[model samples]
Target: MMKRIPIALYFLLAGLCAAAQPKKLDIVFIGNSITQGGGLQHPLEEAPPVKAWEWLKRAMPGSNIQYSNQGVSGSTTVDFLPATNKLFNNVVKAADAFKADKDATLVFSMVLGTNDSAIEGPNGSPVSPEQYRLNVKAILDQLLSSYPGCIIILHHPTWYSPNTHNGARYLAEGLARLQSYFPVLDAIVAGYRSTHPGQVYTGYTGGFSYFKKHPELFIQENGRSGVFQLHPNAKGAAELGVFWAQAIKKVVGRLK
Candidate 1:
């Protein structure tokens, strides 16, 4: 009985050690119509939010994850600030709720700037690259201040319709313009990663490049559309989702 006492204490210590481990996270996603699933419906519905939630659920089963889609159709980076503003309150509410929740670990994934680039400014002038960069930086700055230590993944806007006006040529040009703004984005990510080392910074524009390389990954089956459209079909979204999921998994895997 005396000899067993130390062994029992050791076992008790191990049990407590196991109990002290932190719980897995519940992630949140924020973005635009792309995140909300604007088009492409054949069987599962044409909603990006619904499809994204479904994908996350299926991809990370039993991981105790909760995905909240706060994507409004036609929202710009400039629209995220001003909490009292009717147009942006929904996003503010979601961010506030995440902040208030102690148990939840926030993961913010946003896809903006597309609308800002597409729409003319109040002066009826097309938003310049410099202006777009400033708008993106502003939104990221606010997010960092509000949600310190939270993981953030910023996605570049995907391709637009190739036939609509400038078409694919215009989208390709837009990508070049967008890449120039990546340094600003990098600064933001670096600032956050300095504190929250476990956080992720990823882009789906690379995935678009991948599609260009391997067109077979996105075959036009059952009358489904291909890339360079105004919006992504299920196939396009799935491809992008796979890239995002992989990036996220890599980030989460390194968390302590």
Candidate 2:
């Protein structure tokens, strides 16, 4: 026979539960050319990356959040793993400078696979769907293994290239296939998180939906007639940033 807990004590315990939750996110943006924020003219030159940072900063201004961009121009899913490995090694060397301080939660925003769809290999070999999926999984696994309890947000690659003929369709199809594989990644991460409990894995596919709704925003200059460029323009980047921010915010809320 247990004694009944007082209502005031229950309220005090609830407050303590909320207080014990984690705070302070340290997010790393890792990806290809789009993440590098390329091709926007002066004044708008930093628009792409800046837009993303601004959104995050606004959301958690006082959360001790730190955002780092590890994007590289012309990178694909296959190229990114090596790049991150090098960065993580450097971070390990400069542990004080690179490692997240206490109270910091790690998060990774990844957008890749577009270049793999566009470019052919040395022997003109296109990256097969299976290879693309494997590359994505390797990247996620590496990050999760390195940073225990890290939160990963896997984004679908955005569209570029006009008329759907010049490689856009190929990339779009690759993204679709990538989306199908995300549940597998989620399941893997979910199992890992159950043991590691603090880890989080979330995904969202907003690329196709946004492009289908806002075609005009991504139009590229073509002397007289505008066309779609392989990379997003200023307006397009802002739109992409908004989609990213909203999706990330939702994930953050759920995790919290």
What would the TM-scores of all predictions be? Answer: 0.68, 0.71
- Model 1 compared with the native: what TM-score? 0.68
Maximum-lDDT candidate: 2
Evaluate model 2: give its lDDT. Answer: 0.60
- Compute the lDDT of residue 163 as modeled in candidate 2: 34
- lDDT for 210 (candidate 1): 55
In order of listing, the candidates' clash counts read 4, 0
Write model 1 residue lDDT over 1-256, tens digit each, in one string: 4655588899898666444432445556666666666555642354444555456556555445555667666666666644426435675577676676676567777776555554332221234666666666666666666677777787666544432222212334444554555555666566666655656476444744555455443323221223334556677766666666555655554555
**Candidate 1 displacement at residue 248 in angstroms:** 2.2
In candidate 2, which residue ranges exceed 4 Å CA deviation? 1-22, 42-47, 83-98, 119-125, 162-200, 219-226
